[model samples]
Target: MGVKSDIINFPVSSCLSPTDKSLEFDRDFRIRHYAGDVVYSVVGFIDKNKDTLFQDFKRLLYNSSNPVLKCMWPEGKLRINEVTKRPLTAATLFKNSMIMLVENLACKEPYYVRCIKPNEVKSPLLFEQERCRHQVEYLGLLENVRVRRAGFAYRQTYPRFLQRYLPHINHS
Candidate 1:
């Protein structure tokens, strides 16, 4: 017998301030991870920040520099873009990236999966009807059914539909 365990990993960025030798913006990083855990605790931090620690991380990638930031990224000697006037901070960039991802997902089809706990004591044979009903109601399955019956349950392109079923059909 094998035990099934779900592990969630969150990528946290920490920046060391050279002046005081203390972590900068540690609380904000922890808070962001906590909030993200609430939404995707089962999915394992799907929206982890890419490079959101030091102020000059993005600049280092682009080979740009600031006099103060140069100590942190010595090789990033290229001049910052003058047209933009101000570069986006790590927090702002993370927020914008999340917004863009949400917007993109909003334009695509969505799939939902529901997981239910069997019993309070983790008994395999126990099926509690009231608990199941409460789970269903909390998940809004009834509302989904009503809305789906009122409208098209699924919409697919003609070519996609043909591609899916053509192989299964006998072409007489």
Candidate 2:
């Protein structure tokens, strides 16, 4: 906490954190992310951060009889007269949700189910080999396969190799 720098390093993932330099010098700040360092302009920062999603749409979705739709847009519950504070922006809500999810998953062994889209067309029974192959490569499924195949863990589908399971089969 004693460390001092022009840039305030913290959880930049959740919000647009203005560095000390940006605040003091009235200029843009550079964010060092996992991908790369990106310089973000402070021009119209306030306007851009404002929630742009329409209240009518929010109310429409919130008033939906479906519980899922209603639950999704809690901001819609506000009446024209009862409006006070600005509801969370879509980005803020998403960031908060992700933070909560990470907190919940921190103590648990996370299990992931990676889904690959078979085709761009979203057509059923249409398996796009190239698309699937690309997804497999991108997701490092090959690495997963290699890891699983380590230390004499060879996969076999041959006859006369059922000796280990024969006792169980005979018992059954």
Candidate 3:
């Protein structure tokens, strides 16, 4: 085997829609395509030149402005993101998929990436109340606590890249 790239930086330039919206909450690992301007560096493939992990099912969020990458699980969607105008629900990116994964890296533990809007009071100002800052804070805390039990080392890293690239998802 060739020496793996010690470090790689991938810039997510685009994102995909979905082959079928209803298929979003169906499977843990779905096939996707990386149709974007930038590319990713994946490891342990027969053809590293064309290997990529971004073209797969990921966790879905309630509302998302920036793209949130997730690890599809047997259970229902288990991911979250900030509120956005497009209002992304339990859906997956099918076309224009722009995600990347780095080889051999460590990332933060998984936590209850929840929907901030759920905790808010229904009102005309709901837009201003997208994600409750406090809720996310607690989610972070709970994630740390779970990580402790799972023996996942606590590290400060961005959620997107870490989730996509980590060899193993550090469950919290």
List CA RMSD, all candidates. 18.5, 12.4, 20.5
Task: Give candidate 3 regions above 4 Å deviation.
Answer: 1-115, 119-144, 149-151, 156-172
| Model 1 clashing residue pairs (backbone) | none
- In model 3, residue pairs whose N, Cα or C atoms come closer than 3 Å (at least 3 residues apart or on different chains), thus clashing, are 15-96, 16-93, 16-94, 16-95, 16-96, 16-97, 17-94, 17-95, 18-94, 59-70
lDDT of candidate 2 at residue 3, scale 0 to 100: 17
Instruction: Report the poorest 10 consecutive residues by lDDT, candidate 2.
Output: 2-11
Q: Model 2, range 1-172, lDDT digits (tens) per residue?
A: 4111212343344444455443323345566642346776656543465565667788998999999778667778889777655655655554455555667778676566888889888999899998888788877788887987784555554454586566667453
Worst lDDT run of 10 residues, candidate 3, spans 95-104
Error of 2 at 99 (Å): 5.3
Best by lDDT: 2
Candidates' C-alpha lDDT? 0.52, 0.64, 0.38
> Considering only N, C-alpha and C atoms within 3 Å, which residue pairs clash in candidate 2?
none
TM-score of 3: 0.16
Structural similarity to truth (TM-score) of each candidate: 0.37, 0.40, 0.16
Cα misplacement distance, residue 93 of candidate 3 (Å): 16
lDDT of 3: 0.38
Top of the candidates by TM-score: 2
